[model samples]
Target: MRIRPVGRHALLLDCDNPGQVEAWRAELWRRRDDGELTAAEIVPAAATVLLDGVPDPATTAARIAGWTPGPTATTAAVRHVEVPVAYDGEDLPAVARHWGVDVPEVVRRLADTTFRVAFCGFAPGFAYLTGLPERWAVPRLPSPRPRVPAGSVALAGPYAGIYPTASPGGWLLVGRTGLTLFDVHADPPATLTPGTRVRLATA
Candidate 1:
């Protein structure tokens, strides 16, 4: 675990990969559970985990290095969530052109795969999922749109995601999902957390 300073209040854990992120997330949480370490918050991300508390860098680093997990270790339990989406977006045709196929083929290829929530960012509960069809490597829009409406499903640069809430974003928009991802009333907020598998299909 490589800890780096982010201004003064936050520290970043450079895990470097999704598997590493899961391992560190599991390890840190285990350590916290065993009282081997303490922190205010531990949020895992794509290839990195974050510790947001003004802890002494040296002491925190030492503690992290010393703690070890038991022989039988496992990544946190992940849930498989099926999210339904409608293939209707402003950028659908562009995505189709990029795929060098008809619009229906774009939808077919996307729906055929099950992706994992690599991390959540950009906006609240907006998951940056990975494992897109390798053939479909996309680039972001030349210029981002002013305001992508809430629930606008977008795809860009090997990532797929829903807008979660109406917010300015850069991921290409490909489809819209009827499912609601973030709600203050919901427990822990985002329905799909990192490490969780997501299966998307037509609504």
Candidate 2:
């Protein structure tokens, strides 16, 4: 891991992969909760975690440099959310073809996987979920849609995602849900924060 100053009060930890990033983020949060660290935000991305609004960047950097990440937190320690989906997307057949399986098998496999929120990006409340095995990875569309409706469950590369709002997107759409992923009026606007476990259930 490489730690770099992100300004006067933030440090960006560059991890080797998303798994390491998740592990580090979980450990840092545990430390903060146990009164070992102070930070305003612990934001995670694809393979990095940013410690923002830190009181002492130099000292904190030194402190974390020696720390080694432990195993990922158990499921009981994280939030679990179920999103009911209508598996009737335009790309469902294509995805089935890619996996050399029928559409029903595609749905069954997806529903059986327990996905975790690896990170959130591209748009508000849009979570990049990871859990699908490498063999199930799918490619992005050749061209992006002008507007993929909100709650569209999609896939690209090795990650699955849900569109929080109508926007142009290139991921393969497999289904959609009615869950309100983002709501400005809500206290915690996003439903699927990083580290939250997610399951896509058949609607």
Candidate 3:
């Protein structure tokens, strides 16, 4: 782990991997709840946690430097969510071709694998989920679409994501879910929060 000052009031904690980032973010939230680290916002990214509105950056950095990384003290709040997919996307055959496998095999691989939200970006409620094995990782399309419809489940490199709202995208679409990923009227808005455990199933 490494702590670097982002600016005058934010400290970025860099972790070794996504697992460490998840574990550390969980632990940080615990500490914040317990009144140990009094930061206004604890934002986590792919492999970094940003502690903003910190009282003292140097003190916080020193404190984090002395801490040891391990299992989180609590896991009661981590949520497991299942997203049902139609498996009828236009790019399914292209993805299978990229993998040198049949269409059914691609669906099977997605259904059997479990994923976690490593971070959220590109759009509101859009989650960058990790868990696809390295062997199954693929690159994004050479050209991004001017507009991708909402609920389009896509894959790019090591991450799989769903389009919360239509915009532009380059990820290879393998399937789509009927469920609404984001809602302004909902209490939390987004179904997939950071650290959320997810599973894809064929509907």
RMSD of each: 3.1, 1.0, 1.7
lDDT of 2: 0.94
* Cα TM-score per model: 0.81, 0.97, 0.93
- Model 2 CA lDDT for position 48: 93
Instruction: Estimate the lDDT of model 3.
Output: 0.88
User: If both were scored by TM-score, which would come out higher, candidate 1 or candidate 3?
Assistant: 3
Best by lDDT: 2
**What tens-digit string does per-residue lDDT give for candidate 2 at 67-116?**
88788888678899999999999999999999999999999999999999
Worst 10 residues of 1 by lDDT: 68-77
Q: Model 2: residues >4 Å from true position, as ranges? A: none
| Ranked candidates (lDDT, high to low) | 2, 3, 1
lDDT of each prediction vs. the true structure?
0.78, 0.94, 0.88
Best candidate according to TM-score: 2
Kindly give the stretch of ten consecutive residues in candidate 2 with the minimal lDDT sum.
Answer: 69-78
